[model samples]
Target: MPIQQKDPSRASTYSWPGVLAIALGALSLVVTEFLPVGLLPGICRDLGVAEGTAGLAVTATAILGFIAAPVTAIAIGRADRKRVLLGLTALLIISSVLSWKAESFATLLIARVILGIGVGGFWAISITAAAKLVPPEKVHAASSIVFAGISIGSVIAVPAGSYIGAHADWRDGFMGASVLAVVCFALQLVFLPSLKMKHGVNVRDFFGLLKDPKVRAIFLTVIFIVAGQYAGYTFVTPYLEQITHLSTAIVSVLLFAYGVATVVGNFVGGAFAGRNLHNTVVATVWIFVLSLASIAAFATSPMFAGLSLLVWAVSWGMAPVGTQLWLYNATLHAPEAAQAMNTSVFQLSIGLGSLAGGIAVNHAGLHSSMWLGALILALAVMMVYIVGRMNRQPAVAA
Candidate 1:
C-alpha cells in the first residue's frame, strides 16, 4: 500500500513514497536491533544457560550500541544519508544470516555486536535523513512517522520471534528479520528522495553540542529513566513467578498488558510533550514513581497488582518518547547530535541498570530492587525539573 501525502510541499520532490519508505526503513533496523530480546528464551533453552545469561545477548547489543552509535554518527554525518541507511540495512541482513547459523552462545553474542553497529548507525542517520527529505514544517511529523517504525517493529518482532521459537526454529526468527531488512533496503533504493544535509561536520562540532547544560541534562534524564526502569524490568518475570505467585500463562498476560500499555504511553507521551515538554516529563516521572511503588506494595494482589502494572506500563511508554523529545528540543539546530546523545544515554542506562539490578537482586531481593528503581526515577524527575527551571525553559526537559 502506498503512503498518501497531504501537503503540497510533499510533491514528487519528497513524495509519500520517499517518506513511507524511510519509515519502514526505520522499522526494519529497530527490529534487527531488538531481535535478541525476542530470541532470549529460545537461546537460553538451546545453550543450556540461565535466562539472565541469555539476557547478556541483549546486553551485548546495548554495550556495543552505545559505543558504535556515536562514532558511526560522526563518520557518516557528512555522507549521503540515503546511502548510509542503505548500507546499514545491508549489514542488518547479514546479521540475520549469521544469527541463523550460530553454533554457540559466543557466536550469537558476536553476531549481536555486529547487529548493534548496524542498529546504532541506522538510527544515527534515519531521522535526520528523513527530516531532510521533507519540508521544514513537516520535519517533526516525518520524524515521528520514522520513529513509529521502531515502535511498530518492537511490538511485532518479539511476538514474531516467540511464535517462531514455539513452532519453527529460532534460526527462522532471525532469518525473518533479515528478510524484512532486504525489503526495507529495496524500498529505500526505489523511493528515497535525495536531499541536502548540513555539512562540514567535524568531531569538534559534534562535541560542542555536549557542552550545553540543557543537552547534558536531557541526556542524564534519559540515562536515569531508562536505567531505573529496566533495572526492575530485567528481573520482573522471575519476581512475578517467585513473589507474585503467577503461573507462566498469567505472567505472559501481565507482560502483554505492560507491552500494550507501553505502546499507548509512547504516543500519549509524545502528544503531551509536544504541548509542554516540562510538565509532561514531571507528570510522567512522578506517575512512574507512584506506579512502581504501588506495584511493589501490592505485588501479591492480582487485581491491584494488575492495575499497578498498567500504570507502570504507561510510564514505560512515556519515558522513551519524553526523553527523545527533550533531547531534540535541547539540540535545536543540531538534532542529529540530540539523536546520537540519546542513543548513548539509553544504552548506558541499560548497562548500568542491569548491572545495578543484578547487585540489588543478589543483595536485597527482587522486591527491594523495585524500590531502588522508584528512587532513581524520582531523582531523574528532580534533575530534569531543576535543570528546566535553571535554563528558564520551564519545561524543556520536564
Candidate 2:
C-alpha cells in the first residue's frame, strides 16, 4: 500500500532542530562507520592482522547494515519514529564504547556489527523523517541537510582519526565518536517530535518495489557506484603512503581537503538533482570514472593525485543525493520501503566493494583496485543513461 500523504498545510512548519538532530545522528554514525578506513594501519598493527584483513572492520559494518536496513524498516511499522531514532542513537554510543575497549580484532568487529545495525536503520528512516520535518516543497533541502552530515562526518573522521592515531592512539578516535553520539542522542531527545507512521510497511512492499524498472536501475547504479567508490577509497591511505610516499601529516591534510570537497558537492548535487536528476547523475558518474582513473594514472604525482581526489570527492558528495532523489521520485508511493532497499543495496555495495578491493589489494596491488573501481564506475554511467531513457518522466521539483 502507498504511504498516505500528509496534509501539505500541516507540513509547512519546519522543524530545524529536529532535522539538525537527525543530521547529527548521521554524523556520528558516519564517523564510526569510516573510522577504520583511516586507522587501518594502527588497527592492523595492534591486532596483528594484515591491511586487507583489517579492512574487514568496514566490511563488518556494511554487511550488517545491509541486513539491518530493511529489517528495521519492516519491524518498526507504526512505531514512533522519534523513539526509534533515539534508540538507534543509543546503539551508536554503545558500539563506540565497545570499539574503544576492544582488545582483539574479534571484539572490534563485534562492535562494528552493532554500529552497522544503527547505521542501516538510521539511514533507512532518516530521509523520510526529514521529509516530514518540512513542507513538501522543501523536502529535497531537508534531505540534503542530512547528507551534509555524512560529508561533514567524512571530513572529520579520516583526518581526525589520522591525527589522533599519530599523536595519541586509534582507540581514542572511537572514544571521541562515542562522545559525539552522546551529544546527538541528547539533541534528538529534546527536539525530535513524535512521528507516527500512517501506514505500516511490510516485506511485500519491499519486494513490490523491485518490479519497477526505474527502481531496479537506480539500485543497480548504486551498487556499481558505491562498490566502485569504496573499492578504491578503502585503501586510499595506503595508496598515499606507499604510492605517493607521503607522510602522515600530508595524507591527513589531503583527506581533509577531500572531505571539504564532498561537503561542497553535496549541496551542489542537491541543487542540480532537483532540476535534472538524469543529467546530474550522469555527470557525477562520469566524474567518478575520470577521477578514479586519474588517481591511478597519476599515482606518482602528488599534485595530480590530490586534484583528482578533490574532484572525486565532489562527485562522491553528489552521488548519494542524486541517486537517492532518483529513487524517491521513482517510488513515491512506497517511499519508506524503497528507501530501505536503497539503504540495503547501498551498504551491500559498500561491503562488496571493500571486499573486492581487499581481494585485489591482497593479490594484485593497490593501483589495481583503482583501475577496477574506474571500470565499474564506467558501467554505472551506462546504467544511469539507460535508466534515463527508460523513464522519461518530468523532473520532480524540490
lDDT string for model 2 (180-277, tens) is 99999999998887787677679999889998878888899899999999999998888888898889889989888888888888889989988987
- Structural similarity to truth (TM-score) of each candidate: 0.85, 0.91
* Residue lDDT tens for model 1, 59-137: 6677777886788877765566667777887877787778888889888878878877877777766777777777778
Model 1, runs deviating above 4 Å: 1-12, 159-169, 194-200, 235-249, 274-276, 358-372, 393-398
> Model 2: runs farther than 4 Å from truth?
1-15, 133-141, 271-276, 393-398
Q: What lDDT does the true structure give each of the candidates?
A: 0.73, 0.88
lDDT of model 2, residue 357: 89
> How far does residue 7 in candidate 2 sit from its true spot (Å)?
7.3
